[model samples]
Target: MRRLACAPDTRPLISDRNHLGALAYCYATREEDCLPYRTARDFYARRVAPELPETVLTAILLVSPGRSLTRRGNVAELPRGKQWFDEGLPERLHHFCTDIAPSLCPTPPTVINTDGATPETVLAQVAGVLADAGLDQTAQRLASATAHAPRPPLDPRFVDTYTQLGGLEAFGHPFTPPIAHRGGTVQLCRLGAPHHDPAGHTRLWNPLGPGPWPPPGPAWSR
Candidate 1:
């Protein structure tokens, strides 16, 4: 369940029976709106794919909100004609199909459209995506979604830690810090199901683990 900010060239394909997921946000018109997206995609293909554990499941969300040049207001104007992509307006269609999809071995990448869905809907889509990827246990996935909001606050600490992992720089930029710093924030939202033993014992599951065993996250302690 590791999240890495990467470019298309470096993005890795999930090559095992593990459940995996990813989110990609692109601005169709303002393709240049966020240089980080392209950078992150490239990073994953080259550096991140090689080191992935064979048992890990992979999932990705590609969000491409069409770009616009209009400003929210004129009072805070910098350049009159300056253009920027609207924060969250356009719907994300299933675009940019990646080779990584077929690479998932037994599990395949599920492409979701963020066009008209709410955050909760999108999260649910992600859960379904992971399930289709062969990471069974959907009931737990629903429970995991309850513990937190659709969007989680970004933790800077996690970004820093991931950066230290070897070959991480492939995801970094020269003048700025790693794209993961920003993209990672969007990915910090924890959503998944709690792992339960056949005996009916509930346990915590951490999605961030590289292993394919039980998913990761805390269980409701009764």
Candidate 2:
């Protein structure tokens, strides 16, 4: 999306699939996801937070059930064919569609439920939602924000490392908002996930790697 905005004479685009949806689906599955909440948060921090004024999270709750029973395969005329939904997949989808997805947003997103609405109706509602969210003059807002995005706060524990590593340029900014993670304080930057462990050890998750790994420093080498 950002790349598109940079196209000469191109206008800002409306992105349908944002981190919000991906996070919701990832949570719904609850698998050993390699890039779950972390991916979503990074995107929010790097792109959405600075570019957009407001967010719109659409919930197509009806698809949860419909997906499970939908037809598939070549020609795909018969029910319970290819793409047969997994057991509990529907439930999880429904749960995410209705509940968990909305909670993760920094602010409550304006949700539009497209259970049984026509295309015209959905489009109209979305237009209203965009207007209410004050998303007018997208190009202007994006340009301005790029120049002066609100400085997201940093975890004090990470201040020294961030400074040494080259603050905004090398580490980018704090991707995740202030949130408690599993048994530790986690703050993600562009380069890595800096964690202040409850056991009093600091570690980092390599965002570019497959998973968490030791960071470069005298302390971690030990």
Candidate 3:
């Protein structure tokens, strides 16, 4: 037992419920729902955390309320995979942010709210925090740095809407890269979604329009 504890190469065991996922369920509609999560949180702090590394930092991620509710509704409408969601998810998320997550660590946990953001943006915040904690991973930094890079070759309009308008920055950071759909290309960003036609003409798109994102195409069709 002494030799095993002295091992430097040991990796931390990860349990999905070890973190915020448990406290989240604690806010569910019933008292019975709270017990398991409360017990799990207590066990981890008492039994698991001591055996693990003394250094600990918790990073809590939250989605924007608008998107969270939208995705929640979307998931509910799916014909299958209903088990992953519940009507109370929004309330739980809110409670975690306002009530529970703030009091977690002796020092506050780094909380990043992912509202109208690309995966890279959210990941960048996490990587930046970990770097400060003296544990830096090269791949994660590279991923966040290149999040806006065009996957397939970029179209002229996809990069620059007009010569006088400078570049894609005017449309905000790229979310999904320029993807080939039907024949041309489509890309989504914070401000707009743009489409490139087969005829070398590009058209502006409203991503928030009443349809699948990236405008209508065989791939995105309902």
Model 1 TM-score is: 0.32
Highest-scoring model, TM-score: 3
* Predictions: Cα RMSD each: 17.4, 16.3, 14.9
lDDT of each: 0.37, 0.48, 0.49
Model 3, range 91-114, lDDT digits (tens) per residue? Answer: 566667656765654445567777
For the record, the alpha-carbon RMSD of candidate 1 to the native fold, in angstroms, is 17.4
lDDT of 1 by residue, 1-222 (tens): 222222233443333222233323332223332335456556666766666554444455544443212223423132211222234322322233354344532344445555555667766766565454444464246436753434332345445443333112222212222234323322322223223333433233332335754323322110
- Cα TM-score per model: 0.32, 0.39, 0.47
Give the candidate number with the greatest lDDT: 3
lDDT value, candidate 1, whole model: 0.37
Ordered from best to worst lDDT, the candidate numbers read 3, 2, 1
Model 3's alpha-carbon lDDT is 0.49
Candidate 3: regions farther than 4 A off: 1-17, 29-37, 49-54, 77-87, 139-222
- Candidate 2, residues 1-222, lDDT tens digits: the string is 001111224444566456665565555544452356567666766886565443333323244456345422223232212122444645666676566655544455555555566545655555554444454455334333333346568867767766664455445557565556665556765553233333433334332334434455522110
**Who is ahead in TM-score, 1 or 2?**
2
Error of 3 at 215 (Å): 43
- Scanning candidate 2 in windows of ten residues, the lowest lDDT window is 1-10
